[model samples]
Target: MARIELLQVADAVAREKGIERELVLEAMEQAITHAGKRKYGQEHDIRTDIDRETGEIKLMRYLEVAEEIENEATQIPISEAQERNPAAQVGDYLADPLPPIDFGRIAAQTAKQVIVQKVREAERARQYEEYKDRVQEIANGLVKRTEYGGLTVDLGRAEAVIRREDLLPRESFRNGDRVRAYIYDVRREPRGPQIFMSRTHPNFMSKLFAQEVPEIYDSIIEIDAVARDPGSRAKIAVHSNDSSIDPVGACVGMRGSRVQAVVGELQGEKIDIIQWSPDPAAFIVNALAPAEVTKVVLDEESKRIEVVVPDEQLSLAIGRRGQNVRLASNLTGWDIDILTEAEESERRQEEFHSRSEMFMEALDVDDVIAHLLVTEGFSTVDEVAYAPIDELAAIEGFEEELASELATRAAAHVEATNRALNERRLELGVSDEVAAIEGLDPAILVALGENEIKTLDDLGDLAGDELIEILGDLAPSIEEANAVIMMARAHWFGDEEPVDGAEADEAAEAAAEEHERANV
Candidate 1:
């Protein structure tokens, strides 16, 4: 290429890819020089340069000026070289320029490839500098085009990619549309810099709230935690440092206009702005919004809650298809189960009858008189009965002997609860369907309501295709879900049942009933 044309190419490419012209020139010189060595031969000591004015490349042999020349490849006699062209004097070196670059055929082919690769590398480094520190920051872009699987977003100075996974579900961008995304990552690679953008990350919601809510930006209102279902719904837990300002109301904006703008930006993604609470129970209840929890029954060992609601409100609390409950459990990190009016009543009556029967059994045994054992807060009968004395003694107000008696009575209760629970399980039948959940999180169960993935055993049967079909884009994440399921299943079956809340209730009631019957 001519020198002027070379310079023009450099200018155009540098501008197009946001690279420096000097860097491009340096890259070109090094690349051409390397090609010169391989084409002619690395055996020759060669130097190459692109004339600044001509944009033409020049190659030459660089030999040292010496008293006597013995090696033709590297040394030249100063005196002998002077006779050829008196431009050189003794002790001075002369440039022995080579033939104009033919770059003919193979040589030309090689040079082109080198320049392309070098420029791509330079562009990648420049992009990395622009985006590496931008994590959690928002940027606006013009939708240049939508490729097969993602959108090309053009920032004023650079471009980024929003892939299918990064997109909020059911949301899309059209060519030339204006869009905003949270920069998720900027990676420098051999090919180029990859600027990753996301619209579905939880932090996106947090940052968006900060943008729309002044209190959040100014630190008057603080976002404690956020859990999201992306395009479908999101739950953000916020708190106000200044007691006078209502955090939830501030986020909702006056007449819901502020949050509405953010919602519209996300293509109508729903949001639930909630006040945060330090109390887990309160937080759990608040998290399950749109569904009023009449009462929250917590089992300490289980770290679970049984949420009781009006029978009519079950579907609402669980959300249209249970999204509400799912978000709540994720937000609180607690397993929750929803109970209705009839279910709660049956549980209570069963509890009373079970205790009465256990006490009646104790009365029949003479040695066990007026037993003063404490109900170690167990909810089910069998857990205490089959449980070890040490496990029972671990409960508050329990002694070794008391644990022994309680464990024995608990054995009976557990045996009974097991028989009944299993009979119900049998009636449900073991058909082709599998409900493979390891243990039940009442809250998560309530949230999952109808969307439940039955069991791990069942999950293993699902082929990747089937799993993908069930979750759509979420199908790829089935592995992670399976991991949690396996862990929970192991915990449910392990010796470490840890006496859940329901178990504790049974243990405590057994103690009270046994004491009453002995005295009578």
Candidate 2:
């Protein structure tokens, strides 16, 4: 290629592809190097360089002068190199300039192919670097085409794709339509950079709100959380650091203009902006707005909340198809179960009766005594067994002697239950190794043995969800199940610290084996 022609081509390709001109020049040089290798011998070390300022092409064959010629193709003896140039020394590379070749049809096509491949690689790299950091930011683009229920969007300099599932429900984009979406992901693939866009992501709505509401962008009001039902309804939880600012009001703007802007972008999706509170109960109350919550019962251990609403507001709290409560649960990061006042009352009564019955059966106490125990917040035999004798004696009509007797009976009952469970576990032939896993209590062991998880290997092979399903309500949460499984598999990792009763079992086995060997 001519010097000026090469420079003009490089500049044109750089401008068109939106890449650095140096990259195009490097690609051209690589193409020249490939063509040179084909014209000369493929075994020779051919290198090519293009001048940045003048675009002058230089092709040369390089040979290294070594004490011993390792490869005749690319290495020469130091003495032979000194004959070519007296100043040449060992470990020096000698370059022989070659005239630029005139391209035939095949050579020109080959050079163009190499240039195209390298330029494409550079373009993909450029696109990846440009958009990788832009994930989660809102992007504006024109719909370029629709393929397989997905839309390809042209974002001026780059192209992105919004899969059908990522688009709003019942929404479609035509070619040339202006669209706004969140850059959910940018991935480097063999073909090119994959820019994944989403219109229905909760963050897209949050971003739109941030753009419309200056308080949110300026950090005066913070968007704590967002949950969406795509085109139907959504909820946003916001909090204000400034005591004077009303976070919900600021997001809603004058006459609901700000939220309306976000809703417009979401294709008429309804938005509820609620003020966030540090107190979970208060936050839940705010989340279930327009529906009056009569009471809330929170189980922090289980991360669940039972929300009781008035009978009239039950339907409103649940919304159409339980959308309201679902979004509220997502917003608060808690499992929410909505109940009516009557339902809550019935549940409470049933729980009271059940606790009374449990105490009556376990402690052999009368109905009145059981009711008293239940009223004093003693629900389990373990609680009664572990309670201080003085605390039980303080109960109305309870003497210290009677409290002590009850405590003794409670302890005996719990021991009996555990003994029965252990007997059953042994009868089922659960290996001591399985039972010795750190988190596997007697009940869990019985459950595991019943399900044929009778060894440590079996327990280790179980996934968290599998373990939870096997143990039913007695199983720990998924996180705890995973930890238990890891403990079970610890012996496989070579560190092999004995867990629980594993060391005792091993010693007993060794002693029994020694006895058998002596008898033999």
lDDT of each: 0.71, 0.88
lDDT of 2: 0.88
Clash totals, every prediction: 38, 0
Clashes of 2: 0
User: Weakest 10 consecutive residues, lDDT, candidate 1?
Assistant: 365-374
lDDT of 1 by residue, 19-90 (tens): 999888877887778777886778667888887777878888776677777777777787777677667755
TM-score for candidate 2, residues paired by index: 0.84
Candidate 2 local Cα displacement, residue 220, angstroms: 1.4
Q: What RMSD, rounded to one decimal, does every model reach?
A: 14.6, 6.0
- State how far residue 312 of model 2 sits from its true place (Å): 1.8
Off by over 4 Å in 1: 1-13, 49-58, 62-112, 299-302, 362-520
